[model samples]
Target chain A: MAYERKIGDTILSVDQISLAFGGVKALSNISFSVNQHEVFAIIGPNGAGKSSMLNCINGFYHPQEGTITFKGNTRRHVRPSEAAREGIARTFQNIALFKGMTTLDNIMTGRNTKMHKNIFWQALRFGPAEKEEMEHREVVERVIDFLEIEAIRKTPVGTLPYGLQKRVELGRALAAEPDLLLLDEPMAGMNLEEKQDMCRFILDVNDEFGTTIVLIEHDMGVVMDISDRVVVLDYGKKLADGTPDEVRSNQAVIDAYLGVAHDDAEE
Target chain B: MFYREAGQFKTSYRADQGILTIVQDRFVIGAFAFVAFCVVPFFINDYWANAILIHVLVYVLAALGLNILTGYCGQVSLGTGGFMAVGAYASYKLITAFPEMNFIVAILMSGGITAAVGVVFGLPSLRIKGFYLAVATLAAQFFLVWVFNKFGWFFNYSPTGMIVSPPREVFGFLVTGPQASPEARYLFCLSFVVVFALAAKNIVRGRVGRSWMAIRDMDIAAELIGIRPLEAKLTAFAVSSFYIGVAGALYFNVWLGSAEPTEAFDINQSFFVLFIIIIGGLGSILGSFLGAAFMVLVPITLKTVMVDGFGFAVGAAKHAEVMLLGTLIILFLIVEPHGLARLWQILKEKLRRWPFPY
Candidate 1:
């Protein structure tokens, strides 16, 4: 609410990232930056190293040569956990929700960084631990409401339908109150209704939380509708980067999309 | 319709997050504790106390430990007996080394020491999981027993090569050694069961517990979600070992009073606790208690029936008991791999949805 629909200074920058797996370059000299309170989408075919770029941003993969800067903190070697603590949260393309746990528990786990109770307090489960848990429970409950997944709050995520599971995964990432939310195919495998719901939640999160978002999606209409800036990747190289219309109309992106003529989706 | 929470309303987050939210569940738990604390101590004699209750309680604590690691964290440890031995030896050394040490402090220190050792053995878990991790824990079990057996210092150089729990008083009540009364010893061990059980309940209800469960379900996802695997796994090992350590100390100080390492904490003992978790239920605190009871009672019942009710020899009855127990454990695994806990849960769920035909 503080900055309504405003995309500010760069919150995250990836410079000269080149990730290779033993002589195979997965990404070659890739670079991109996402602004504050903006929805940035990375688009490419399956092997465009799009997911690899997101991984490098979150410190899951240390690119052979590059620096990832987040919230004014830049580093080459930082743990994924450190990235999380620094308020960078992410979801997986494959829906990495803790399967056996309840939806509420899965989201509350995302609040682990905010919970500071030590083992002694936790062992007692009174005083600070109880108070801390109550505080976070409210937050998680709100997330459940926002995602409209109140019915599955107590059900194990493994037992839920795929679309609801993806919603729960987003609920988990959002529970972190992250500065930059990286969603790897948040709408993957979703039908039209689910995709619409996910798009709404993503827009709501960016607007209400004033959170920066970097997501990778295969759906063209969803991407053009939501993403403020689009990064097109092809064979581990940054092909084009601009607003939705600019990238959509670019010849290279058109050719890269392989003449499917997705530029019409912007209409 | 019988098991309903219809009238019980929780308006606050605190009430909503209770260990047992339902009014009937709390009432049942309260009644159980009341009987254990007030009623059973008065009616129990030496035969019942030593033969069943104390053994069950100590194993309850140890089972809780293994359950936390293997059940909650999904680490699948087979070294509970070894960790318990570490606790027993540590307590012996602490008490014998300093006679003036308070029994409670001595017990806690023993658990702390065992926790340290547990963390060491838990390192292999980072590199391996499932059966291989279990084998690593088994190695820990053997190595700890060997250390206690080979070293004279653990046994205080006694010719028997065994450590004996010296007489110790808690609040002027003799609770250890030969001179202690069954009621006092039983009460002391029960106190441990009550306190640690509460602590375990609390731990499992909080963030630490969630992290363990998260790690159990999926380690990579857990790590990405900011649940540190090293911290979560090691803490599970340390805390679980602490519970098992206290159980071991109580086993030595209050239950057995003295014991040789090899006989006391063997691979069979490890299997015994493992069976308790498997039979009782993995990842259910209630399962550990159910497991301990099932583990302790049925065999004693079998042995007694074979030897006393029938005309079988004591040794023959023991063999028959072992065979019967093996069969029962297999039957339990086949019937409900989640253990009695899941069965109990199914019953409760059915009860909640009662008055309607299936």
Candidate 2:
């Protein structure tokens, strides 16, 4: 709390993005902009294209219509690896930790983009490769300490509980030292305590790293408390985008959540 | 009590990240190396070398290759034997074309050639996965064998379709052809296996290995984390093929002395290496060695027990060997799918705890 976190100019802007799977529209004309060092939340009902929107931003799902401008580079056909190179890293809704690998290794893998020692040197396992690995291992160990999962450092993530797995996934994304972090339901299926822990971690990451977060969460209370701005989507369309107070008072978002009154039913 | 690491501590990440981090492990490996490099050569004879040591080393090299592709990279390849054939034939052509070329260079270049072939076959992996990719590689297996079989050029227009290894030497020691000593042959193959196995271990523990595992575990997430699928899968294929190719080169030049492609490097050869990784423990470097040893030792042990001890006919014993291997593969799959390497790890874990119930 000693150092104030400031929200800066727009770092990512989605302009009229529309995505469809055959006849079904996953997201239609959805547009939003995220400012630097801000927690931007996307909350929507089930099947409201919440994941699809994240997918689009991360280049997993390419929009048929608009362009996504990230760090001033507009792209419609960005590959996920390219997006990652451009400083976008993410955790999946279902924890995507490398199950066979230890937690330490899973987090170390997040530093894949940073490490550049080639296959030949890696085979040698000496000089540059050894130095690179040790340096990255130090960074990964710090991430492990920060996430407070040092106890499970060598444990295979497949055997870990859901809450811990989610935390480890966050640890993996954090290990990348990403500029833009995409977290899909980082606290889903967790108890209140776990949710609180996750909220603290997310806020800490934002404050400590000054990372721009694009989070998709269904928890309204956590969303309103932590997010600088919230976007609501329904039926693959953006309903509202504003500060939590503004969106909370919007009648359209209310109707989208609570069904609208049918006046014709009185007839 | 001996294996306990109660007082030992690592002060640097470099020390901590070493492949043999445990003091006891380094000592054990050092002992094993001493036995392998120094002790084995002294006690070796034609029967031991040809029947067990040479065969096991060759299979270990091949299995390590396949394990890199199938185990570490999570890419199933049935083209291993075919790739090995490419190595054998390439080495044959290289040695014959440039008779003055060093045998080591010839073997390495053969490995390089197989790596290129592996990359070409690996291209389809970018589009397909799992069983479909397996089928694609299976096609490579059949097609490669067919090419070797049909082409007389591979055999250098040999009248009987047999490519024989012309006598080759390294430091005044005959390593290839019929005149090669069993000790020399074993040592030569052993040297390649030791160096390559170490290299394989290093590669699998590094960034390239991490990328391969990342793609294997969850490719979508891997891609999102900046690991390219094309690079990971293809590199797996190339590295795997390189090891297999080197194994093939040794198999021909040092062990067999002469090989017929269709007979030597066939579908059964492919399945043989596959079974090694399955029973040895998939995705483990030690498993590759353990699996290859298990595979090579099992049949030999079965034959010795059945034919030599029980006085069973050699032909019948061979049939029993095949049947027992099938049963063992199934047993390993059902009971401990992680294979012999996992069993070894479990034993080490128990050893560390000793009498403590906890």
Clashes of each: 0, 0
Which parts of model 1 have CA positions greater than 4 angstroms off?
Answer: A1-4, A259-267
Q: What is the TM-score of each predicted model, taking all chains together? A: 0.96, 0.98
Interface RMSD of 1: 1.0
Candidates' C-alpha lDDT: 0.90, 0.92
Cα distance off (Å), candidate 1, residue A69:
1.3
| Residue clash pairs of candidate 2 | none
Q: Which stretches of candidate 2 lie over 4 Å from their true place?
A: A1-3, A263-267
Output the lDDT of residue A137, model 1: 96
Q: What tier of docking accuracy does candidate 2 attain?
A: high
lDDT tens string, model 1, A1-267?
A: 234477799999998989998977899988888899989999998788999888888878988898888888888877888888898899999988888789999999999988999999988887878988999999999999998998888898999999999999999899999999999999889999999889999999998899999999999999998889999998898999999999999998888776545444321
DockQ of each: 0.72, 0.87
Compared with the true structure, model 2 gives a TM-score of 0.98
Instruction: Please tell me which predicted candidate would have the highest TM-score against the true structure.
Output: 2
